[model samples]
Target chain A: MSLASAPPVRARAVLPGFRLTFGTTLLYLTVIVLIPIIALVIEGAGIGPARLWDIVSAPRTRAALRITITAAAVATVINAVYGLLMAWVLVRYRFPGRGLLDALMDIPFALPTAVAGLSLTALYSANGWFGAVLAPMGIQVVYTLGGIILAMSFTSIPFVVRAVQPVLEKLDPALEEAASSLGASGWTTFRRVIFPAIMPAWLGGVTTSFARSLGEFGAVVFIAGNLPFKTEIASLLAYIRLEEYDYEGAAAVALVLMVLALVLLFLSNLVQIRAARYGAVTA
Target chain B: MTRALLIGLAVVTTAIFVVVPLVYIFVQALGAGWSAYAANIMHPLTLHAIWMTTLVAVIVVPVTVAFGIGAAWLLSKFQFRGRGLLITLIELPFSISPIIAGICYLLLYGRQGWLGGFLARHDLDVLFALPGIVMVTMFVTTPFVVREVLPLMQAQGSDQEQAAVTLGASGWQLFRRVTLPNIRWALLYGAVLATARAVGEYGGVAIVSGSIRGKTNTLPLHVELLFNDLNAAGAFAAATVLTMIALVVLVAKTVLEHRR
Candidate 1:
C-alpha cells in the first residue's frame, strides 16, 4: 500500500534550487561590490606602507577625522532622542497635519545634498532669515561647527526615524494597556516595557545616523566653507585631496573613512541581530 | 502625559529642522516677481541642466532597476555560504560615503586609474565624460531599489513560485507570471526612490562629472556653480525645481505607504 498509494514526497528531503541562486548572487556581489572595494585596496597598495602611515598620521588628516567623528557623534546623540520621539509621535498620535509631519520625515531623503546645503546655509547665514535672529544673539552658524552639526543632523534624521518607526508601529498596545491596568504608571510602563522593545531599534537608528553624518560632504561643504583645521570633514578633505590631484593622499583618507563606516555598519548589524534574537526569545 | 510631551517634541523638531528648510527653499526661490521668475527659469543653462539631469535619470533608472531586480532576486531566493556577507557587501555603497564612492570609480576608471590608462590607450575617456558621470550616479543609486524590493520579496513566501514550478513553468514564465506580479508595486516604489536619489545625487557625480556647463553639469551641480558665482537668485531658482521633485517624491512615498 505504501508503494502503490504513496504520493510523491521528496519535497521535504529535496530543498529548493538554492544552489543556483546562491552562486549567481555571489558572482553578482563579487562583480559589483567586492571588486570595487578590492580595487581601492589595490590602488592604495601602490602607495606602500610608509606613505600610508604618513597619509593617516598627517595633521590635516587627523584634524579631518576629528571633525568627522565629533560632528557625527554629536548629531547621532541629538537624533537618538529626537528621532525616537518623532517615531513615537507618528505612531501614537493622530494630530492635525499628522500626515504632513509624517511625510516631512522623508524630506531629507529626497532633497539633494547640495540643495540642502545651500538652503541650510541660506537659512543660517548671517544675512539669511534664521541667521538674522541668531546673529543678534552673537551666535554665528555659517562656517562653524554648529552649522555643520545642524546640516548633518538634518540629512541624518530620516535614518533614525525610518529605522525606529516600523518597530514602534509593531509594538503591542495591549501591553501598555495592561501595565496601566495593573496600576503601573505611564512613565514606569514605558521605562520597563516600551523602552526595552524599542531601545535596540533606537540604537540601530543612532548608528546609521552617525555613519551618515560621518560621511556627509555635500551639505557640510556648502555651509562649512571648507576651512581646513576647523570645519573640514573627512569627506571634504578627501574631496580636497582629489581637487589637488593628491590621489594617494585621497585614497589613504578614503580608506580610513571606509574602515570607520564598515565598523559602524558592523556594529549596527550586530545590534539588529541581537534585536531579532531578543524579539524571538520574548515572543 | 509625559509621553505626549515627548511625542510633541519629536514631531515639532522633525517638522522644524527637516521640513521647514525644504519648504522654505522653494518659497524663497519663488519670492521674486513672475517676470523675474520667467526670465530665471527660461535661461539656456537652466534648460540644459534639466535636460542633462533627465538624460542621466533616464539612463540610470533603468540600468539600476535591472541590477537591483537581479540582485534582489538572488539575495531573497537564495540561501548559501557567505550569503550574509554578500548581502552586507551589497549594502556597503549605501553606508560608505558617496564621496568615497566617487573615489572608488575614479580609482578604477580615472585618467591614471588602474584601467584608466588601458582605456585611454584605446581612446576611451571615462572620467570627465558623460559615461563617467552616469556610471558614478549608477553606483550611488544602486542600493535603493534592491533595499526596497528585497525585504518585501523576503516577506512574501515563495510558494507561488513552487506552485508554478510544479505546473511546469519555465524560469522566465515563473518570474513573469508569479514573481513579477507580487513584486511590481515594490519594484515601482524602488524605482521611484532610485530616480529621486539619482536626480538629486551630487557628491559622487560632482566628483566624476567635472561640472562643465551645458556639457556635464547636472542640476544640483549647476545650482552649486550658480551659488558659487554669487548668482543667489539663479541658484535658488534651479534649486526650487529640484525641491519640487522632492515634494512629489514625498507625496508619492506617502501614498504608496498608505496603500500598503
Candidate 2:
C-alpha cells in the first residue's frame, strides 16, 4: 500500500551521465590497471606451480625475501613508535615551527625516491655528515641492513603519522579528564584510554607502512648496496631478474611481494572498517 | 618538562630523519662551486631527462584528471552493487609495488609479451619508450585524483546536480556549472598530487625505461646514472631540481588544504 502511494523510482531521473561516466571509469581502469596486473598473474601462472615454488624456494630468492621482511618489520616497529609520538606531539603540543614540522612530514611522499636515496646515502656514507660522526662509533649505516631500514622508515613514516594524527586530534578530552579525576596518572590515562582509542588506526597505519616498506625499491637500492642475499630486497631482486631477462624469475619474485602487499592492504582495510563501525557505535 | 622533552625529541628526530636529507641534497649539489652545479644542470643528458620527465607529466596529468573526474563522478554519485569492490580496485595500485607495475606493463608490451608479435610486425615500440613511461606513471598515480575528489563529492552530495537536472540543464552544462565549480579545488589538489608522483616515479619508470641515457631515462633515472657514474655532484645537482619541484608541490598542497 505504501508502494502504491509513493512516487515511482527511476534510477536515471536525477543523473543523466551515469552510463557515460561509469563506462569511461571501467574502460580506463581495465586498460590502465586491471589488465597489466592480470598479465603479471598470467605470466606467473604460466610458469606453473612447481617451477614457481622452485624459483621462490631458491636460496637467493629466499634470502632476499628474508631480508625484505626483516627490514620491513624493523622499519614498521620504528615507525609505529616514532609515528605515534610525532602524531601525539603535533596534535597535543604547540611550539615554534610546529606547523613547519607537520608540513615536513609529507616530504617522503612528495620527494622523488631517487633523490631521497642519493641524499640519505650522502649523509650516511663514511665521509658524509652523519657518517663522519657515526664512523667514529663504528656504526656503519650505508650499504648495510641498517641502511635498508633507514630508507624504509624514511619513505613510510608518514603513513603512521598521518593515519594516527586525525584520530588523536579528534579524541574526546573528557575521557582523559575522567580517568585523571579517578586518580589515574598521565601515563595510565594514555595507556588505558588514549592508546585504546588510537589502537585501530595505529594498527592500520603500521600495516600500510609495512606494506610500503616491503615494496620499497628506489630509495633502498642506492643505500642498500644490493649485495645478493645480504642486502638485496625482494623488489630489487625482481628488478635484477627483469634486467637479466629472466622473466619467469622476475614474475615469481614479484608475485611473492604482490601477495604480501595485497594481504597487508586487506588487513589495513579490515581495521579501517572495524574502526569505522566502532566509531559509529561510540558516536 | 615532559612537554619540552617530547617536543624536543620529535623535533630532533624529524630533523635527522626528514629535514637533514632534504638539506643534504642542496649541500651536496653545491658542494663543488656554483659553476659545477650549473654545468650539471646544463648537461645535455640532464636536459634531455628533464625534457622527458616534463613531457611525460604533460601527457599523464591531463589524462589522469579526466579519468579521475569520470571515476569520482561515478563512484560518488551512484549507489550500486560492487561499489566497494570498484573503489578497492581503483586503489589497488597504491598497495602494489612500482617495480611490479613495471613488470606488469613489460609482460604486456615487451617483445615477448602478449602483443609482442603484433607490435613487432608493425615496428611499433611501446616498451622502453615514452609510451611505456607514461603508461606506468599513469598507473602509479591513478588513485590520487579520485582519492582527493571522491570524499569531497560524496560529502557535497548531488543536491545541486539534481536541481540542475530539474531545470533541464544538459550534462555538460550541469557538470560545468554545478559539479565542476564545486569540485575544482579538490580536483586541482588531486592533479597536483598526481603531478608530483608522475614527475618523481622512479622504480616503475626505471624498469620499463631500460635506463637509456638521454633517450628513455627520466630525471630520477638520470640522477641514478650520474650517481652510478661517480658523479655525485652532478647527481645531487639534478636532485636539487627535483627538490625544488617537491617544494613547490608541498607549498601548493598546503595552500589547497587551507582553501579546502
Candidate 3:
C-alpha cells in the first residue's frame, strides 16, 4: 500500500493487452494516416516556399480559396441561425411528426455526399423543381456559388442540429418561467435568459459545421460545375491538380485545405471549452 | 402567431432541404418504372459497383472495429504522456478533407510518387487501384469507431473491471464477460457509422479509383459516372440504394440514441 511499492501494480487500466493494442493502434495510424500526410507535406515543402507561394498565389488558386472560404462561411452562418431555430423548434414545441423530425436530423450524416450533390443539382437546376420557380426571377443557383453554399449547407446540416438539440432540451424550464414572470415576452425571455445559456453551444455547433463545409467535396463538386476562376473550390481544385499530374500544385492546394482544417479544429476546441465552462455556470 | 410562423419556417426549411432531396431520389429512382429500376439494379456494372463498395466496407469495418476497440481501451483505461496529442492526431482525419487524404495516398503511391519505383519494381500497385482506394477509405473513416467508443469507455470508469480482476477473472474472461457487453451498443453504432461513411465515400475513392467504370467504381462513384453519362434514371436508381442505406442507418442511430 506504500508509494514505494511499484505504484501498487497500476493506478488504473486493470485490463491486460495494453502494450499490444497500443502498439498496433500507433502502427495502423502511422501507415494509414501519418505517412501519407507527411509525404504530401514534404512534397509541398519540397517545391520550395518560393514556388509554393507562386503556385498558391496564382489568380486561379486565389479565386478558388476565396470562393471556398466564402461559400463555406455563408453556409455555416445560415446553418448556425437555422440550426438554432431548428433545435429550438424540436426541443420546445410539441407537435405531430416531432419525433420524425428529430430523427430525420441525421439525414445529412447518413446520406452520401455524392447523392446529395446529384439531388441538390436536380432540385436547383433551371428546369428542376425549385429551380423553375427561382429562374423566373433571374436567380440561378446551380453552376454558381449559391449552389456551392446549398450543397455545403445540406451536408453540414446535422452538426448544428445535433450539437444544440441536447443542450436546448436540457435547459431548465424554470429559467423561462422566471424570465416570463419578470415581465418578459417570449422573445425577450429567450434573448436574456435562454440565449446566453445556449450561445456557446450554438457557437460550437456553427464552428463545427463551418469546419465541415470548408472541406466538403463530393456534393460541392457536382453542383459547382467546376468552372475555374469562378465556381471552383479548393478541394475540387486539389483533385484537378492531381489529375493534371501537377503533384506540386495538388500538394499546395491540399496543404491549404489541411491548414484550414487544423485552424477550424482549433477553433472548435476553443468554443467547446468555453461552452463547457458556460454550461457549468448555467447549471 | 409568431410561434407558428417560426416553427413553420423551420418545417419548410427542413422539408425543402432534408425531406425533398430524400423524396426526390426515391421518386426519380422509381420514375423509370419498376422494371427500369429493377434493370438498373440488376445491371452487371451496377452489381459490380455494389460488390466493390461492399468489399471495401467488409474489409474496413472489422479492421476499424478492432483498431477502435484497441485504441479506446488503451486510451480510456490508462493515462500516458502525449495522450492528448494522440487523441488530436486520431481525430485529425475527421476534419481533414477526405480529398486531401486521397491526394496524400496518390502522392505517396501514384506512379510518379516517391515509392512508385519501388512499388513498380515489386510489381505491386497501390494507387489508382484497389489497395489505394482501401487505404484512403480507411484513412477518412478512421475516427468514427474510436470517436464513438472512446467516450463510452472513458465515462464507464474502470471500477467494474477492477472489481472483476480482484475476483480472479482472467483478462480474456473479464473482457468477454464484462467489457464486451458494456460497450457492445456503442461498438455497433461506431461500426454502422463507419460502414455508412465507407460505403458512401466519394472524394477519396474518386481520386484513387481512377473511375475505372466496371473495374474500380464504387456505388457513389458509379452514380456520379451515370449522371455524367446522361443516364439520369440509372443514376437515380443507384442513388436509391444509398438512400435506403441512409434510412436504415438513421433508424439504427435513433434507436441507439434512445437507448442512451
Candidate 4:
C-alpha cells in the first residue's frame, strides 16, 4: 500500500484507462440526456413561479396523477405476480404450446402502442364480441379506468416475465429438493429457498413494470377516453396542452412528467443493479 | 390439484387476453368481405397513408441502425470518459414517453422553436412536415439498436481486434474482416428490434406528423383515423397487417435464439 510499493495488482489492471473512458461517457451522456432535460426545465421556468405552481397544483393535475399512479401501481402488482407465474411455468415445465405461449408474451413488445390501444378498444367496446358479453354484466371497460388497467397490464406484462425468466432458467432445482428432503413443507421450501433467490428479481421486474406504465401513452390514449380529472393521464394532459397551442402549459406538464419519469428510472435502475448482484451472489 | 389449476389459469389468461384478441382482428377483417377490404385498401387516402408510412420507415430504419452501430462500437471498444453516462443516455428514450419526445423536437424545430425563425427565412418546413415525422421517429427508435448491440459487443472483448491489429491490419479491414463476422447476428437482432420499434412508433410521430388524412399518417395513425371514421373493418385490416409483421418478427427472434 505504500507509495514505494506498486499499487494493488487488481487496481493497476483496471485503473489505467478508466478515467478516459469515464470522461468520454460523461460527455456523451450529458449532451444526450442532460441537455434535453435542462431545456425542459428552462421551458417550465417561463411561467412565473406562482403560475407554474397553480398549473401543476390544479385539482385536475392531482386527479390525473392519482389515476396514473394508482392504475400503474395496481397494474404493476397484477403483472408482478402473474408475470412471475408465467415465467416460472415457461422455465420449469414442459407442455404443449409452451413455445407458442413463450413467444406470445412478447406481443406487447412488438405491437405498436396505438395498435394495441385500438385492438383493446375494439375488443372491449360494447358491440364487440367480448364486450358484448361483459356489457350485459355492466362491466364497462372502454373509456373507463378498467380499460386503462387492461391496456397497461397487457403492455407491462412482458417486462416482468422477461426479467424473471432468465434467472429462473439458471436456477438449480437441487436447492428446492434439498429443502424438501430436510422435511420442509412445499410452502416452507418455496419461501425459504426459492423465494429469497428470486425475490430481488421479482422486485426489479415490478419496478420496471411500474416505471413503464407511468409514461405509457399510446395504449392508454384510446381507452382512456381522455376525460379530464377522470380518465385523462399526465402524458395526455401534456398533449392536450400542446393541441390547445399552450406551448408553455404543455412544457410545464411535460417537465413534471419528465421529472417523475427520471425518478422512476433511477429507482428501477437501483433495483436492477441490486437484483443482478443478488443473482450473482446466489449463483 | 391447485398446481394444475394454476397452470390452467395461466393458459386461459394467455388465450383470452393475447390470442383471442389477435384472432378477432383478422376475423373482423375477413368478415368485412373482399369488396369492402379492396375498397378500403384501394382508396386513395388509404394508399397514400401506406406509402407515407413506408417512406418514413424506409428513412428511419437505416438512420437509426447507423447510429446504433456507431454508438455501440464507440461505447463497446473505447475506454472513453463518460462511458456509463453515454450508455444511460442512449437508453433514456425508453423511459421518456414518445409524446414528450415530439415536444422535445418541437422545441427545437417547431414554428416557434429555437431554429424556427432561421429555417422559416430559408423556407424550410418542419414541425408538421415529413422530415419532422422521420426525425421524431428516429428519436424514439434510436436506442433499440444500441441497447441490443452494446451488451453483446461488451460480452465480446477486444481480443479479436487486438489480434488483427497485431497482424498490421487497417481499422476498416479489422472491422470488416474480423469484428463484423462475429457481430452480424447481434447486429441483425438489433436491427429487427429497431425496425419493429420504428414501425410501431405512434405517439411522437402522431404529434409531429399532424395526422393529416392521407399524407402524414403512418400505419398506427391510419388505423386511428379509420377507427374514428367508423370504418372498423378498415382499421382492423390495417392493424392486422402490422400484427402479422410483429408475428413474423416474433417467430424469427425465437428461431434465432433457439439456434443459438
Please name the candidate that would achieve the greatest DockQ relative to the true structure.
2
Tens-digit per-residue lDDT, A163-193, candidate 2:
8988888888888889999999999998989
Q: Alpha carbon lDDT of residue A169, candidate 4? A: 76
Candidate 4 lDDT, A155-238, residue by residue in tens: 887988988787777778888888999999988987888877877677778877887888788889888898998899988888
Global lDDT of each candidate: 0.81, 0.91, 0.87, 0.77
Instruction: Kindly report the fnat of each predicted structure, to 2 decimals.
Output: 0.57, 0.71, 0.68, 0.39
Best-matching candidate per lDDT: 2
Candidate order by decreasing TM-score: 2, 3, 1, 4
As a TM-score, model 3 comes out at 0.96
Q: Weakest 10 consecutive residues, lDDT, candidate 3 chain A? A: A1-10
Tens-place lDDT digits, model 2, residues B101-218: 9999999999889988899999988888888999999999989998888877877878888888899999999999999999999999999999999999999999998989879999
Ranking by lDDT: 2, 3, 1, 4
What are the TM-scores, per candidate, against the unseen true structure? 0.92, 0.97, 0.96, 0.92
Q: How well is candidate 3 docked (DockQ)?
A: 0.58
TM-score of chain B of each: 0.93, 0.98, 0.96, 0.95
For candidate 3, what is the DockQ-based docking class? medium
Better of 1 and 3 by lDDT: 3
How well does candidate 1 score on lDDT at residue A47? 90
Better of 3 and 4 by DockQ: 3
The alpha-carbon interface RMSD of model 4 comes to 6.3
Give each prediction's DockQ, rounded to 2 decimals: 0.49, 0.58, 0.58, 0.37
Q: Is the docking of candidate 4 incorrect, acceptable, medium or high quality?
A: acceptable
Tens-place lDDT per residue, model 4, B161-202, is 776777878766877888678777777777787778888888
Cα lDDT tens digits, model 3, A1-283, are 0011111123354567778777998999999989999999999889999999998999999999999999999999989988988998898888888899888788998999999999999889987888999999999999999999999999999888878887887888888888899899988988888888877778878877988898999999889999998999999988888878899999999998899888977887777776665552343
lDDT of 1: 0.81
